[model samples]
Target: MNYLAHLFLAKDTPESLIGNLLGDFAKGSVKFLYTEEIRKGIELHRSVDTYTDSHPIFRASKRLIAQPRRKFSGILVDVFYDHFLARHWSEYSDVALEAFSSHVYKILVDNQAILPTSLLQIIPMMKAYDLLASYQEIGGIDNALRRIATRIRWQNNLADGIEDLIANYQQLEADFCAFFPELIDYAQTYCYQADRPLA
Candidate 1:
């Protein structure tokens, strides 16, 4: 999952949303810095990433990519899944994607002072570009991957690797359709079992 999915999975609180978004930057034991609810959101973010990486269905999706681009398949698939989630947002939730996107952007922007240092730098760009609303288009995925490629340490080929996603688009959508519902269920159950909020 990526930013939108993490936010979608977060409990409806400013702190929880901030914590979930912080997962990308706050590695290791750093989540302990937050309140219990925020910590739960951070923990949920890691759990979702671990679950997505290990699931047989997600692994199957990664295998569909060509061998040459296989090394970056996980990153590609994560973005691809968000595209599907945005495209099919109406089917999954009653809230319109545009409205939800605006809401999340407001939450992040309004609470900027509380955000992790890394996220504070990125959130402005995300809101300015309207990333969540743009995910319905393949071009958005391409642009996002290319931007990611420039930031990474390695000689990542993500700029050209969007083709892998374009080529296997249908199968990847099917895979996301199959996997996301299960993931939502798992996340809900996890939060419930942990005595944390799910919405």
Candidate 2:
């Protein structure tokens, strides 16, 4: 899961949404930095990442990546899964994808004071491109992969990850369909702390 999926999995609250998103930058302990609710959201985000990365179905999808880009397989699959989730957004949520995207962007911006600097920097682009909803198109994902490629410090072809996805689109979609539901169940039931349920 990437941004869209992480946000989708978050409980329907501003604090929860911010917390889960902070998972990417709020490394190590969040103890004194954020409110307890936000910290729980970050914890939930970590739990989701651990479960997704270690799942058998996700591992199977990673094997479909071409050898040259094998090292970035995890990144590829994470974005790919987001693509599918966006593509099939209606099945999971009643909210329009665009509406949902706008809502999340507002939440991030309105709560910017508590957000990390790294995330604050991308807000303009995220809304400009409408990135969350854009994942529904392969071209959008391709553009995303290209941008990600440039961000890598090493000389590599993470952009070619799109080809692996295209070549195995059907199988990978099948894998996502199979894996995501199980993940949703796990996330729904997971406790961020021993006492707090996700919702």
Q: In TM-score terms, which candidate is top?
A: 2
| Residue 137 in model 2: lDDT | 98
Candidate 1 differs from the real structure by a C-alpha RMSD in angstroms, to one decimal, of 2.5
What are the models' TM-scores? 0.93, 0.95
Clashes of 1: 1
Q: What's model 2's overall lDDT?
A: 0.91
lDDT of 1 by residue, 50-80 (tens): 9999999999998987887789888888888
Residue pairs with colliding backbones in model 2 are: none
Error of 2 at 79 (Å): 0.3
The most accurate candidate by lDDT is: 2
